[model samples]
Target: MQVLRPQTSGNVDRVLDCHGNKVVLISRRRVFSLTAGCATFLAAPYLSLRQSRASDAIELPEVRGGGKIRIGLLWSLTGHLSVIEKPSRDVALYWIDEVNKSGGVGGYQIEPVIMDAKSDLKTYRSAIMTLMRDEHVLATFGGYLSVSRRAVMPLVTENRGVFYYPTCYEGRECWQHIVCTGPLPNQHSLDLIPYMVRNYGPSAYFVGSNYIWARESSRNAIEWLTQAGGQLLGEKYVPLGQDNFDVICKDIKNKRPDWIFSTVVSDSDIFFRKEYARQGLSSDRVPIASLTTSELEVKKLGVSYGEGHILSAPYFQSLGGATNAQFVDRFLGSRFGESGVTHFNMEETYLAFLYFKKSVERVLQENGHVPLTPENVRAFSGGLHLSNEESPEGEVHLDPDNLNSWLKPKIGRFNGLGQIELLWQSSEKVSPKPYLLYPERGVCLSDGLHLPNGTIVKAAS
Candidate 1:
């Protein structure tokens, strides 16, 4: 509710675009955006990541090696993924710009060999191969969908190449090659389902895109809900980018579940919510809860459509703290300009690079050159700790066991003003077991519990 209203800060120039919903104010060196919720202003003193030198534009290295650090940037910039996955790509570039501008990590300029997956499975595999075999990047970063992450992960492990994947994905499959920056089922779904059962209602419905991330997460959501004294009314999955949600929306209306949990992606995510609103449904009656939804999705869907929708993640733009305030402002100003918005997708990716920077610098300091191998990165992960104080998120504890970080969990609601209102957050970061080492289910069954398709594992005694 507390908004920093703009006073006579300086001589300001107002810019109006075709998108009339939001007004952007551009000043000499600062910019502020008037959004549907809170009016956001430039945080000021944003450190320039990339230099303006003519040489910085070239992505491929001049000589390939020559004592320079190279990072592989992979994300879907075009085709089906252009809407949801591009931010992951941009943030990777943002970090590369930051590292290179600061004279690089340990005296070597970092160069990004950027590749677009085009939202295709085969492209994801092929891109990683080129980054490792041809370009010989020190490490690779990017992967939005769990299916694509699953597809490309094996290739990275086969080559023993390090990958910094940033996406809130399904829990299971602890891969040796990936350092996951995204939250898992326990961090978001299990935590979210329990909260809803106690506070919102005990009956819920599940909807998702027809993919591994949505389907598997839905299974865990079912387990968590059942254990929490809640009942699952229904579960369904639609094809990716299936926009016509009339049939599903009609089905849900008839079902009359207390709340809805959605793992839908891309176009389906945006369209379903719009149709949800068009069906005369409001969050007060039945709010849509999601681990995949972010600020960007909300912005695109318009504030009115997602007014009371709930989102649970490690970070949010409205997360009040000195660190969060500083990062959010600089990121919005530098990356997207005054009119730009911040989302969890880019925030996690941004934080991942910052965490990886520490390891890269450590490797360079210990050995004269940055070793381009997964083993070298894994060796330094134990020594590396990304303090919650440094990031917009409270803290990130890097768990070397599964190569996934123990992230502090937070839940928020898109309130009346179209801004995220903090509902709940853990005081400390919780340890994660991606392969279901310690589940919320009381007894860790040696035989392992199985749902429709997914299995929940017990901890090792």
Candidate 2:
């Protein structure tokens, strides 16, 4: 055997022979091979003597294969929900990068397959089908709007795939395949009305885009408002794609309620805000408390128009906590820059990935080296438990019926400085109740009674 010499001149730290083997010279006398395999084999019994200590340091669930785990991310990259979905897309990308950097999940690198839903129901359906059947993704995550999740829920269930829907919505439906990582209306809307009424008095205006979510959410708001001795000034419904808010603004101005309880979704929020600003109505004069306005929307709406707007949701960029701060720092630094982080779909997306990670780890621990297929993921996530600072809503437990987790809701306000400040929190953790009693009650009452058009209903009168 030929003696290997250091490649570098003078004092050398390492040596590489002609055969491309490596060795390290720590001092004038001490020398060792750079190959861990060689080291392990030479010191087998000695290594076995210290196996317990080494095992603790190298503790990880045994994964069957060493490869890349392909994850399909279906999000609204463009179109009506782009503003909300973009953050989620960014977060998913960030998670993929981070996981790869940290040696990946379960010793497998994550390969992300991204597709844009473009906010269209048909497009969402097609994207999920493609990711499931064509791409054969191990799992899928990211949905911002309730409509999109609703459209794909059946497909995901039928395919036995995993979907993490990150949006506050009506909680009447649940599926075993899809995991709702957002708050239900009761967690967000029910108690919020009481809080608003106690602080802002008992008169409110209801405005929303014409959709299943908005309609149902508004109905629940009406019930809570009525129950709290609050009077309904008036209610208006506008079509989803309608841009002109002139009529709605006029209605709001005429009603002049104490506060505007809005359930507007998508681009309607921008239109409503601009219109409200144009009407010379500041948030202080007639504050608009909403269920959907997140930090992402505030950034898009700009400081002038988004200032002082109140929102009730689980996550915010300014939430105080070590975990939240770290998450914000990492997420913003990687995707949106240090100062550009916003509260949007990203928080939910991040939580979804973490939930998936936990579920996968659980599967590995229990089943040992199972394939990370969609069915395996669904089975794993069925019993997944996720708790994090980003989830201000508290610990989210998977619901047995739908396999979705219930997120807590918090109240935040846009401070006109491109930041959202947390204001209030749910007094208690709200459990996931599948049936929306408040909205159902409102629907039943409205259908049963024949109230004349343009009639103002008073709860306390």
lDDT of 2 by residue, 119-236 (tens): 6655666667666665567777877656666656666655556777876778655355666777777778877888789877789988887666788888788888889999998888
Per-residue lDDT, model 1, residue 16, is: 29
TM-score for candidate 1, residues paired by index:
0.79
Across 1-461, the per-residue lDDT of candidate 1 in tens digits comes to 01133333344222322322112122121121111101111121111111112332323222222467767778776766678777776666556655666777667666666676776665666667667766667788888877667656656655667788887887666455677887888888878999998888999989998767787898888889989999988888887768888988888899999999999888679899989989988899998998977777887778887688899998888888888787777766664333256678888888778877787667666875534355576567653577657877776867755667788888999965556888998877887656563444323122233333465542111
RMSD of 1: 13.2
Candidate 1 lDDT for residue 226 = 85
What local lDDT does model 1 show for residue 310? 93
Give candidate 2's error at residue 289 in angstroms.
0.5
Model 1 misplaced stretches (Cα beyond 4 Å): 1-66, 335-339, 370-374, 437-461
Q: Which regions in candidate 2 have their CA more than 4 angstroms from the true location?
A: 1-64, 335-339, 387-395, 438-461
Which candidate's TM-score is highest?
1
By summed lDDT, which 10 consecutive residues of candidate 2 come out lowest? Answer: 441-450
